[model samples]
Target: MAKDMLNAVKDRLWQWLSSDPGFILNHCERILFMNEYREIERQSSALEKMQLLLKIIIEKGDDSCQSFVDILRIHQAHYWQLQQFFKPNTQGSSSPTVVADGGSVVTAREMENIRAKSINMKIETVSGAGGSQCGNSTGQNPQADYIATGGSVICADKICNTSTDGDFNLSVTVKASTQVCPGLVDETLPSSQEPAVKMIRQHKEKLVDCLRSDCSFILQRAQVKELVTDRQYQNLKDISQSEQTVIDLIDRLMSNGQKSCTLFIEVLKEPEVLRTYPQLKDISWC
Candidate 1:
């Protein structure tokens, strides 16, 4: 029957997607702590392991597996960016760590979704559930809109489309702090050096924490529908070079301003850049 064939096709799609190679690599990366590799050789080995696992996963040709592969590939690309730090051939001014602008910086919701998918990806590899299997949260809500007719279907787990019906809760938090500038010998008392380095370290930690928290809150408050307003979506879909540059420039300026905000006494006392950039709340580059 047509309905039976459609169901079979969908099951095949889900199986392939669930075992996505990229998704599997992410799981391996986390489980093996490949992220901790300090040398190029070690890192290369890690990459090799990842590649092998991915190849095997892809060959399986299941929908869920393919989905896993796609997710893993994305995470692996991120790992590749980190590998530059380990390249042995690169010389001069080498440090133990490399710092970049850091990506969109995932929101808590996104973070949870990634984490949930990661666990599920790993379980899929072991279970070999083949047809379809659901474990861990994917941050998708079962309550999400669905269409159905008069029919009854169930899985061995006694659940229908359980994998698609999940929800994630990401709460927001904020904190405030103040500290004297570090490395400063009070102009009035040149002998005062006790607070310099200590204050600087404290400030740096506080600044990073504050920025992370604010960014998370902003992302949570953002509404995708509002941001992708139909008109804007069309324009964004076909953005011009000039438009892209303007967007990039604005983002850099925004980050720069926030980075320096810690230098401002009042801003440091109670940081609030997110309040101004509410659009950042729900938008993700991916």
Candidate 2:
């Protein structure tokens, strides 16, 4: 069964790859759009492609095909390594002490001393106020800190915190590069809504500008087309009216034969006189 599956898979891949010269071209656009989702699409797509190759081997049913399968199997062992960055809640533990081979040791005190050495650490100005998710990092709570002053909020500050739970004393230095949470957004704080609302208003302004520009461009193009079409219609109408006038004049002259005969003789005599006077023939019609 596995052999059949592998053979089928390989055939499918070969077919897809060979089907169109432009198939790979379409994937370039997908790769660009995938950037918005923070590269998750890229990782998942790679895994799927690898799995398809495995299916191809099972369908082949030959001992020689096992070589490719074995190679893939080896590569699969490092799946966790590739997936580590995308894994959630894998941030390093805040606990000071971890259990060693024989006994438990305190690392929390040591970490605090590390924080006390201002000479070693750099100062940064954090923008946001309270506890919330940082831009690319899972967020830590600001109020949970014990110290709230000087842009340095110690995680031990929250009222709910207990002593030496190891979760406490996770001090954060609000550096200039740090992504700040706007504030604590609870029922009690009216100020929490300000930043969110302001952001919405800004977005609305941008949308309005884009829409206006698009409308202006469309209106200008439409006006030009309308002007050209209107001019063409008026010109055609004028030409048709002038042709009708000529037809009417011709019909009148034909109906009145005597009058038409007199006018034709007069016109013929005038051209003959002009021919006799060479200077008159060359003169302006007006």
TM-score for all models, in order of appearance: 0.15, 0.15
Candidate 2 stretches greater than 4 Å from native: 1-48, 62-65, 81-286
Off by more than 4 A, model 1:
1-44, 73-286
In lDDT terms, how accurate is model 2? 0.31
How well is each residue in 152-204 modelled by candidate 2, as lDDT tens digits?
A: 32322113322342233343344443433443334222211334322323343
Instruction: Provide backbone clash counts, one per model.
Output: 35, 27
Cα-based RMSD of candidate 1: 25.6
Could you tell me which 10 consecutive residues in candidate 2 have the lowest summed lDDT? 97-106
> How well is each residue in 169-272 modelled by candidate 1, as lDDT tens digits?
32222222232223322432211122332233334433334444333332222213132123323333343443342332222212222222223323233235
Angstrom error at residue 221, model 2: 48
**TM-score of decoy 2:** 0.15
Global lDDT of each candidate: 0.29, 0.31
